[model samples]
Target: MSTDRTDCLFCRIVAGDVPATVVATTDRAVAFRDIDPRAPLHVLVVPREHHPDVVALAAADPALLADVVALGRQVAEAEAGGQFRLVFNTGPEAGQSVEHVHGHVLGGTRLGWSPG
Candidate 1:
């Protein structure tokens, strides 16, 4: 929100200061493989601009949120045969580790239903 959070890890990744296994990228977003994958096809789609969480992103830029989702779909299609789950963890209790808003693309196998 403040232009770019210099200390945010994803911002560093976007700025090319941090190394990441980027899979797909657009002018508004970037898609990269998750280091600790919960699924076979685990990738993260994040906007180029920094936002604290998905709600902030959506409120500030709905179109960018759509772009992030669109990119997630593209990643799922290419890596998971067009079937996937897109997850947005909004807070620490919700499993959001990074401050930057991102959508996790999970697939490549039948996912179990375990929300807890």
Candidate 2:
């Protein structure tokens, strides 16, 4: 997978080329608030390095993938009382709008199961 894509939105955010409501960061990951939040606590945890999707990230760097998830949990604990749902949308059909691999941390309220 590519390291950085100049045209990628998340890459721009990571590079400080674009502004984001950053919640947290680590050597391996960055967590920021989602523009269109689906929940009160809607943060996205992304690896500092670029990877097309979560599967690519898992295959190329499992540790980085774990780092992303760990950051997501950290954000959840701080923002959502330690309970959250981590979602990785792999493709367009799966609701992945950006190419960069990210884990959506959703919580802050009682969640409902309506994946339609």
Candidate 3:
């Protein structure tokens, strides 16, 4: 596990300090049920280590980024039966409410181009 931020909600979840409907967990990351799901099979895959966003994570190690994405694919296949979308919100303007980087797996229905 990586160093955690005391105030990060995803960090808390990673530490088991907070409860979440975790769908899958790996040495490097975790996938949990989204509190506010947009699709029938919506989940959030976050790294155990905190990164401000995906770009930051990518800068550190492409492999770790790949791991997180691979986890997202697994979540999608299990939850959506192989058809899904992977979305990453890079900043507040992009709709990322949490500071921790995460990959969203949404499917089981058609996802629109605009989240609106």
Candidate 4:
């Protein structure tokens, strides 16, 4: 897709160099199970191409940002049985482990404000 070794773990997953419990995959995105899930239905929706973060994506192509959001909602509604929350851990301070941009879809139960 994009250049390899984007200094992002999610990039590796997208490249298939790393293993992940993929839930769904598209030409532009990939949905996979979160390793450290905060809820019973926790999935990470990541773009096949690496973007530094949301801000970068917005500046590059705003419409692309919508794709990630839409896909996250689709995955959440489908897999969580109806409703869920979408989360994007943008930076290190926000608990983003991987540099590649991603949205976390959490549901399947009443998830509290603080992650469990």
Candidate number of the best lDDT? 1
TM-score of each: 0.96, 0.96, 0.94, 0.89
Please, what are the lDDT tens digits per residue for candidate 3 over residues 13-103? Answer: 9999999999998999999999998899989999998888999999987788999999999988887888999999988989999989999
Number of clashes recorded per candidate:
0, 0, 0, 0
Candidate 4 pairs with clashing backbones: none
How high a TM-score does candidate 3 get? Answer: 0.94
Q: Candidate 1, clashing residue pairs?
A: none
Ranking by lDDT: 1, 2, 3, 4
Models, CA RMSD each: 0.9, 0.9, 1.4, 2.0
lDDT of 1 by residue, 19-107 (tens): 99999999999999999999999999999999999999999999999999999999999999999999999999999999899999999
**Candidate 2 structure quality by residue, lDDT tens digits, 1-114:** 564789999989998999999989998899999999999999999998999999999999999999999999999999889999999999999899998999999999999998
16-108, model 4: which lDDT tens digit per residue?
A: 888999988777788999998879999998877778778877787677778887888888878787689988877898887778788888999
Per-model C-alpha lDDT, please?
A: 0.94, 0.92, 0.90, 0.82
- TM-score between model 1 and native: 0.96
Q: How many backbone clashes are present in model 3?
A: 0
Residue pairs in clash, model 3 = none
Window of ten residues with lowest summed lDDT in model 4:
1-10
- Lowest-lDDT window of 10 residues in candidate 3? 1-10
